[model samples]
Target: MSDEGRLIAGRYRLIERIGRGGMGTVWRAEDEALGREIALKRLHAQQHLSEDELATVHERTRREARSAARIAHPNVVVVHDVLDDEGLPCIVMEYVHGTTLGALLKGGGALPPGEAARVGLGMVAALRAAHAAGVLHRDVKPGNVLLGGNGRVVLTDFGIAMATGTSTLTKTGEIIGSIDYIAPERMRGHKPGPTADLWALGATLFQSVEGRPPFRRATAMETAYAIAVDPLAPMKQAGPLEPLIEMLLAKDPDERPSAEETERALRVVASEAPGATMGTATGGTTEVAWASAVPSRATATVAATGPTTSAGATLTDSGSGSVPPTPISGGGSGSAGDGTGRPRRKRRRLLWSAAAVTLAAAAVAGGLYAVTADDGGHGRKGSGTATAPTASEPSPVPAGFRLVREKTLGVTFPVPDGWKRDGRASAEQVTYTDPSGLVGLTIGTVNPAGANPESHFQNIEANTKLNYSTYRKLRMQRTTFQGKPAAVWEFTFQGQVRAFRAIDFGFGEEGGTEYDIYLSAPEAQWDTHRPVFDTVKAGFRVG
Candidate 1:
C-alpha cells in the first residue's frame, strides 16, 4: 500500500507528501533502521503507460537514481538509498526543509536581479558537479531547484539524467526536458552536451528575472516555434546580468560560453548587487570571454555602482557615485552580449529543430511536466457580494492574551503569550507559530483579483482539494465581522506528521485589499486551540 501509514521496504515509513512531479510523489519519510528522517520518491503509476512501458519506466528510475547517487556535492541533493517497494522503485534522499524556486516565484512574482544571480550560481555549480561526474541533467528548470532552509540551493529530481556516452532511451525524434528551456541542438536530434545544459540555465535565469520564460506561448506548437525562430524577448529587469544571459543562450553550441565562464559572469553579477553576497563556487575556473567591447545601458548602470573583477580587465566608473570603481583582474567595461558577432543562421537551425523535437516529445510522452504546490498557504482571493455586519465593538480579550499590532497590514489582534511571529514581517505577510510547528497563525493580503471573501474561499478550496490528502471542508460561508464583509473557512487535512484542523477568516477592506487570518493545529488538539481563533477574531480590527 502506497497510502499514508504504509511502510516501504518494511523500513521506510511513509509520512505526508512534500511534493509531486511527473516522475513521482515525494514524501517525508522516517527511516526506522537509522532513526532519521529522509525523503522518499516513489514511482507514479502513470495513466498512459502499458505493461511494457511501465517496465521501461521502472528500469529508467533505478538507473537514474543510481547515477544521481554517484554525484556528491553540497549543491546537489544527496541520494541515500534505492529500494524496490512492492514493485515500485523508491529513492531515499536527504530531507530538505524549504521551498522550490517555482514556489518562491509564484508567491512573489519575479525575483530581484541579484537574488536571481545568486540562485543561478548554485544551479550552475550543480550542473558543473554533475557534468564532472559524466552525467547530463536533461531537465533543468525552476521546479527542479530547491532553496533550503539554511540558505542553500539544491538541484534534485534527476529522473531523466543521461550519463556520458550512453545510448538514447527516448525514441527517435522524441525529446525530454521542459520545452521552454530546451536547447536548439537537442531539438534537432543532436546529442546534448554540457553546453546544452548551459543554454537551459540561461533560460531559467531569464524567467527568474523576467517573471516568464523567454519563449512562452499559448500552445506547445507556438511556444516551440518561438523558441526556434523568434528573437529573445527584451529583458527590462535583468540589470547587470544581460550580457551573461545572452552569451549562455547563444543558439550554436560552440558559440555559447563554457560552464566555467558562465559561473564567473554569474558570480560577478551576484557580487555586484547591492547587499548581495556571492555563494561558494566549486570546481576549476575558466578564462573570461568578452561578448562585446562597448557597455550596454544596463551593464553601464551596474558598473557605475560597484566594483567587478576579471582577468586582465579594467572598469571605468562613470561617476554614478554608487561605489568607487575597483578593478580586480580581467575586469573591463560592461558590454552587450548579443551585440557581439555570431552567425544568425544558427538561430534558425535551433528554431526548426526545437519545433520538430517538441512536437515529437509532446506526441510520445504527452509532454514533460512538474506540479508544485504552494506550501505556505499564500493563496489568491475570489470575488463576492458585500453585506454590512450587525456588530461594531469587539469582545474582551481572553485572559493572558496580548494585542499585537501589524502596521503594514494595518490591523492588530491578540496573540497567545507563547505564540511568536516567525521572523520580522516582509512582503506584508506575517506568521506566528506556537512552540511546535503543528500549530500556527498566518496573516497576509491576497491578490484582490475581483475576489470577495466567500468566493475566494471556494477558489482556494478547489486547488487544495486536488493536492491535499483527505481534505475535508467543514464550513465555508459569507458573514460579517467588525462591520466588514468577511468569510470563514474551516477544514481538516492530513499533514506530514499529523492531521490538521484549520480555520481561516478573510475580511475585505476598501480598495480591494483583502486580509486573511488563518490558524491551524493538530486535529487531535483542535478543541484546545479553538479558543485562540475566537480571541483573534474578536480583537481583529482594520485601521
Candidate 2:
C-alpha cells in the first residue's frame, strides 16, 4: 500500500499500511465523517476471483460486522463499518495500539510462566463473552489476542470465525484456520463449531508458554504428521508453565478446557508471574516489532510454515512488551502452502519406471485419524524438543520431474516441488510421487494404444474419485494446469483419504505427447491443501 492517500467507499482516507495477507491488505485510515482512525481491510486480486469465493468473503465480512457489532464487550475488538471497495469487500474496524504477545517472547523468547497464564485467561474471558453472544472465534491464536494500553486484552479479526448456533458459511470440505491451529475434525474436512475455537486457543496458549506452537515439523509434510499424530504437551522447555498450558492445549476438543474453566484456571495461575501487582506485570523492554513497539496494538516476524504461514508469521501479541521473531525484510515473501492431504501407499516402482503396477497390486491403508478431545483438561507436556530447522541444511528438492512433459504442442510448465516425477519408457504413462514417496501419480498419454479421448476421459472420471473419513464425492472440472487447458477431478475417500490424481495431456499442433497429472493424499489433508489443486491448474501450461 502507498503512503499517498486513497479514499475507500468514498468516506475513509488511507493513512498507512497496517498488515497484509494472502486474503487481503489492511490499512490504518481515517473516517472523514467521524474524524476517527479506523483499520481498513482491502482485498487485492491479481487474477479474477471466483464468484463463490467473492461471495463467501463478502458474506463473511457482513456476518463478522454484524457479529462483532453485537458483542460490545471490552474484551472484543470493535467493528465500526463494512465497506465494499470497488467490487471487493472490506471492513473498517477500531484500531487498537499495543504490542503482541509473540514479540514479547521472541526478543529473548521466554516469558514468566504466570504472565503467560494471565494472557491465556484474558483470551478466555474474551471467548466466553463472544461465545455467550453466539459467536465462536474459530481462528484464535497468539496474534488475535491484542493488548490495550489500559492493561486489557481485546480479541480481533474474525475472518474465518463462525457464529455459534448457525450454519457455516463454507461447505464441509472447505478447511479454514491456520493449519497448525486447525482442529483435527476440521483437518478431516468437518465443519467445526465452538470446539474448534478451543482447539486453536490451546495451540495459541502453548506458544505463549512453550515459545513455539505445539505441532513441530521440518517441512509442511512433517508438521501435518505432528499435528495429526502428536499430543499437546508443554513440558521442560516451558515446564514452568505446566498444568495450565497442558489444560488449554489439549488435542481433543471435548477433552480441552472450557472457556470458563480456562478463565478460572488462569486467574489462579496469574496470582502466582513476576509482577509488582497482580494482573499487572506491565513493564518490559518496549522495543518490539512493527505496530507492536509504539503500542496501539502489535505485530512481529515469524516464517510461515507453508505458503500460508508467510501471512501467518509473527502474530500481533498486543501486549505492551518487547518484540521477537524475524521481520519480513529478513525473509522471503509469499504465501506458505498449496495443498493438504494424508499419505497414500503405492507398490515400489523405479523412480522413472515404465510399468503399470496393477492398481490392485498396492493400496493406501485406511485408519481413524486421531484428533484430541479434551480427555484431560490440563494440557500434558510432551518430551520431544520442538525447534526450527537448522539454517545450515537446505530443504531437499523432489527426486525427479520425469512426470513427462508434452513439448510436442509447444506447451510445458514446471511441476510443484517435493513431488517425484516419472513417465514410462512408453511415454504413455507418467508418475508423480508424494512427500513420503509412498503413493505416486499415474499419467496415461493421449491415444495410448487403442485408447481414445472419450475412453480416457472416462478413465480420468474413474480415477478422480475422492473419499474422506466420513464422506465421498466424485468432483471434476475443466481447467488448466501450468497454462495448458485440461480437465481436473477427484473422488473423495473418507477415513483419512489418500488418492492418486491424474490429468490427461491435450493434443498439440501435430501428433504430440498428450500429458496427464494425477495426485492424491490422506483425508485429514483435503481441507488444508485443497488450494494447491487450483494453483496447479491455474499454472497449467499448454498451447
Candidate 3:
C-alpha cells in the first residue's frame, strides 16, 4: 500500500515520500500534536531475510537514533523520536528544508575555495561534538551533509555510526559504509578512531572544490586499490583549502591532524572567503543557496571473506558495482548475491591482501630510491665554494639595496640593505628577511626545468594552495626574462598573524637549470614594499 497519508502511532502522519535509499524510505510527515513538519525514516520490508538478519536490521535502526541523539549540536540533525509501526522501526527527525551537499555539488558544480571552507568548518564542528559524545560517524559523505535555507550547515545520517561502548551490530566479515570515503586503516581491517571520520571529511572537501573524489576510479575494486596504494591524484582548483584536505586524507590515521587543528585551519580559510560570515556552533550564516533536496538514507554494506584480522580484508558489493563496500578480511572464499536470490559472484580474496603487499613494497622502494638518487653538485649551502654569476657582469646596485650572490645557486640578485639571510638556507634555496621579518625574498632553482616555466609555477602553486590558507592567486602567466622563457606568479596567503602577498619569477629551458626569484611582504605593506621586487628583478642574473 502507498505510505502517503498514512498515520502511524496515531500522532504523526506521513504526507509524502521525500527520499528513498537501499535501507529505508524517508517521508515528509506532519507531527499532528505539534503541528510541525518532521522527517521519518522507515526500514524497508525484507520478507526474504532470516529472523536473525531481520532482527539485526531492526537493532541497527534503533542504534542509529541512539547514536545521533547522543550528540546535541546545531550542526547535527535533531532526532525527535523513534517508534515502532507495522513491525518496522521508524525514526522521526527535524525536517530540514534544504538541499544536500551532494545534490548541490551535482547540480551547481564544485564550490569556490572559501565556500568549501565554510562548509568544512560546519562539518568539523559537528564531528568534534560527535567525538566528544563518544560517537563515531563512520559514514561521512556529501550526501549526508545538509545546507539549510536558514543559513545552517548540518551533518545528518548516522546509520552506520559506532558509539564507543555499543556492539557493532554487523555480521562477521561485513564492512558497512560508503566505499570511497572509508579510511585506509578501516579498509585494512584495523579499528577506526576519530581520525577515520576526519579522512572522510577530507574526501568530502576534495569533492567540494575539485568536483571529484581524489582517489575515485572506475570500479569498486579499482577505487579500493587506489585508496589503498595510489598516490593522491593532482588537484587543479582546490585553492587555499587543499593543504588541510591532503592532511585529512593521509593514509595513516595517526598522521592526520587532530580535529582541533583541522577546525582551526578551516576557520582561517572561511574567515577570508569572499561574502563569508562566521557562524557560531549553535547556528551560523552561510553564503550558499540551499535547494529543496533530501538524500536517501541507505548505507552501502559489503560482505567479505576470511577471519577478521588487524590487517583488514577485501570487500565486494552485493550486485551494484557503483560504490563498492570496503573489505573486512585478509583472505577467504564467500559468495555475495544481489539481494535477488540469483547466482552470487565468488568473492575475490586476494584483492586487498595483494593491495596491502603492494603498498608495503612501494613504500620501501620509494624510500630506497630517495636514498640512492643523485643530487647534482648543488650540495649543502656552506658545503661548496661559491660560483660567480655567469650570465652577465654586475650592474650598479640601486640605492638602499645591495647586490647579493648565492654561491650554491650561482645566482645574484639585489636585496634591500637591511635584509639578512635566514639560518635555514639550504642548497636548493636561500631566504632573506627584512628587519621586521614580515617581508622576505627567496632565490631558488630547479635542476631540470619542466617543459615550461608557467607550468612549473602552476605545479608549485598547487602545493602552495595546500600549505597556505586563504591563498588567493593574483596572476600566473608566461613571459620572458633576459630572452629566456620564464613565468611569473603572484598571490596572497594568510600568515600566522597577518596576510602576506608574494610574487615569484622563474625562467629556463626544459632539462636545464631554472632560477626562481621570489618576494613576499605583509599585505598592508605590499604597495610600499612592491618596488623592491621590481628593483631586484631588474638586477637578477643567473649562470
Which candidate number would show the highest lDDT if scored against the true structure?
3
In model 2, the number of clashes is 90
Clash tally for model 3: 7
The local distance difference test score of each candidate is 0.60, 0.46, 0.63
Q: Report model 1's TM-score to 2 decimal places.
A: 0.53
lDDT of 2 by residue, 102-172 (tens): 55656436556677766777777778888888887778876677777777887887876677666688654
Error of 3 at 234 (Å): 1.0
C-alpha lDDT of residue 133 in model 3: 99
Best by TM-score: 3
Order the candidates by lDDT, highest first.
3, 1, 2
State which candidate, 2 or 3, has the greater lDDT: 3
* RMSD after CA superposition, every candidate: 21.1, 20.8, 22.1
Tens digits of per-residue lDDT, candidate 1, 226-304, equal: 3432335568998867767865665445555668767766776676667765544322221122223111211111110
* Model 3 Cα shift for residue 513 (angstroms): 40
Which of the predicted structures, 1 or 3, would earn the higher TM-score when compared with the native? 3
**TM-score of every candidate relative to the true structure:** 0.53, 0.52, 0.54
Candidate 1: Cα lDDT at 48: 89
Off by over 4 Å in 2: 1-3, 46-48, 103-108, 279-543
